[model samples]
Target: MRINRLIYHEGKVTNPYSVAPTSHFFGSTSQSDPLFWFVYACGPLPHTRGYLLFGSTLLSGWPVSTVHRKEASRFVPSSVRFFSFHYLSSASSFLHPLKMEFKKPATVLNLANIRQALVRMEDTVVFSFIERSQFYESPSVYAPNKYKIPNFSGSFLDWLLLQNEKTHSLVRRYESPDETPFFPDQLEESFLPSLNYPPVLADYADEVNVNDEIRTVYIEKIVPQIAAKRGDQDENIGSTACADVDCLQALSRRVHFGKFVAEAKFQNEMAHYTNLIRNKDIKGIEEAITDSAVEAKILERLIAKGHAYGTDPTLRYSQNPQSKVQPEAIAKIYKEVVIPLTKKVEVEYLLRRLGDDDEAEAQDPQRKTQLMNRLLSNSLW
Candidate 1:
């Protein structure tokens, strides 16, 4: 991966050899004395500890005029020492195609290695001692209190007594601490917010139980506000029709089953959707149409708020096919409004169904009881 660039004197001199005989040879010789300069960049090195030498110097007749004494004399007078001569004499000659080698020192763990070995040795010693003690055959070695018994029932009773003794000994060795005092004075009061709401009484509220009234109020007041906040936060999440109904149906089934779905399953669904879009499937196109409509609506809202258009030159044109509005027409309507309207309608219908289900569950206790019973039966059987 090394690249080398060579630069030399730019000007050219006429060669007396190629020119007419009238030209002076001395003038042409100036061109032959061109100084060659080279710049080299060697790509990433393994150890970054080596020295570089010019490989060209190893070639035969290199420093070309050095072999010719007459030509060399022109550059270097007889009194002057030739540096090239000294360099060639001292150069180490090696075999062609030198094989480069790198040596890395073997790694050794210090005190940690010794500590680990010692710990393992201690464990082995403890295990061996336990194993050796277990081999003792005399019953008196384990328990000296057992009385001599000859009858079959007496032997059974002796064995049971030995087991009970072992159990009691082990239990006495390891026991939990005494229970903490239960008095309020001994307890530290936590400053954390209380989850329980206080009772609210009214003439109309009297018909409903206090707990039920509180819960109903929470659902009516808190739940809708939470839902609205979530919807606002997720406003930018582009809505598109599910590319694979079968996959979506599978996901819906898993949601209904309350089973854990792996990340791979979700990624597979995303990949499937991407492939469908790449293949220009009708469903994918429909999804794109729906998303485009949503994007247009968002853009319209931004424009109505006196927001400046984005700086991107490509976005100067509305993405709609029917949009013929000029770039300067800031209050222009999107051309393909019908598709988004249709998608909005479809989404609104689904939302309404969900809302109706919530309302039905809240109003009808019988329905709730039946649903709970069905879920319980499904789980059990």
Candidate 2:
């Protein structure tokens, strides 16, 4: 049988023999003769018969088929069946659609870039801390049931953070390798599209979650130290909680980014790290990598950053202008906690990196070679 001529008007398909309306083309009407409405995007010429395989089941309008008028009705049934069979055969083939894959940039997380991130984070941390400090360490904020969040305990900060992460975790926040959530269990499944982040970091990047440690340090040490002089009344609980959470997230980002630094360092000096790691020399590893001068400089920078951010520049010739924010305390936090924790992460990652390299070599020689090549090419080492 041949489909001689076909015409499309609105939702109707008319060939030389018969007119097929939308009602007849759809539902139970077409069930008995389902192949009757094969609609191809391209005009059906005799040569490109293969194109007809992609035809839709829906009734579509074409100007008209080219076949002769007398033989149209006789050819329609066989032509439709052939089209259906072609479609099924093409669909079952092993050939797949081309998928786009994004590789993470290898040079994205060197020491310079990581330090720049730290510098940027300083502004965020200071601004957030300043905003939270407006509430002046209100005791009621830490009181239970202050904020009614489901399946939560502890302070208003905790509840607020819990709910915020629950929503944001489904978006871009959780997927970012740099962010570590305070409440992992509270995070909802990500409803957002995948960003296809590059896995330039070591495998140990997934193993660490410093959120709990950060939260504890902030609450027990950083807050009291900063707010030691804050003697104010309980006011503006909501703003305070929000600011607190923002500061917490900023801090988390800063601390967790240690993974990137560690990755960069290990990639650069794999041999040096391998020697220390093989010998199980944690102290030697620390000594080899740690620059006391650099650490001292970082502490000084923090102190300077605190003073610059905390003090009002507008006040001219002010006598003994007491700053609410403590610069020395910030310096101390970095000097003691933040710097040490980052180095600790470096050591931890190096320890695991040796094993990961060995495993990769054992399992996939090509992959190990590629990784070795990447490490060798990195001039930053």
The candidate scoring highest on TM-score is 2
Candidate 1 C-alpha lDDT tens digits along 1-381: 121211111122233122112121211223233333121111111122211122111111112111122222332334332333333222211101111110100000111222233233323322222222222222221132343544323322233433433443344311111011111122333344332322111112111112222223322332232121322222221111111112122222212111011111212243443344346464553453244554455446434332222223455465642212222222221122212332332222222222344345445557645753443332220
RMSD, every candidate, angstroms: 36.8, 20.1
| Runs with alpha carbons beyond 4 Å of true place in candidate 1 | 1-301, 304-307, 311-343, 346-348, 351-359, 365-381
lDDT per residue for candidate 2 within 1-381, as digits (tens), equals: 222222212322345224333333222323333344453422222322322222334334222222332333344455664555444333212111111112324345446556666777888877777666666665666677766767767778788888899889878687777777887766787766788775676656767776777777877777666653454355566776787788788888877777777766766666677677788999998887688887787778877878778778765247764555677877787777777777776777767776655544445547656864564243221
Per-residue lDDT value at 236 in model 1: 24
TM-score of 1: 0.13
TM-score of each: 0.13, 0.64
| Candidate 1, lDDT over the whole model | 0.25
Looking at candidate 2, the ten consecutive residues that score lowest on lDDT are: 92-101
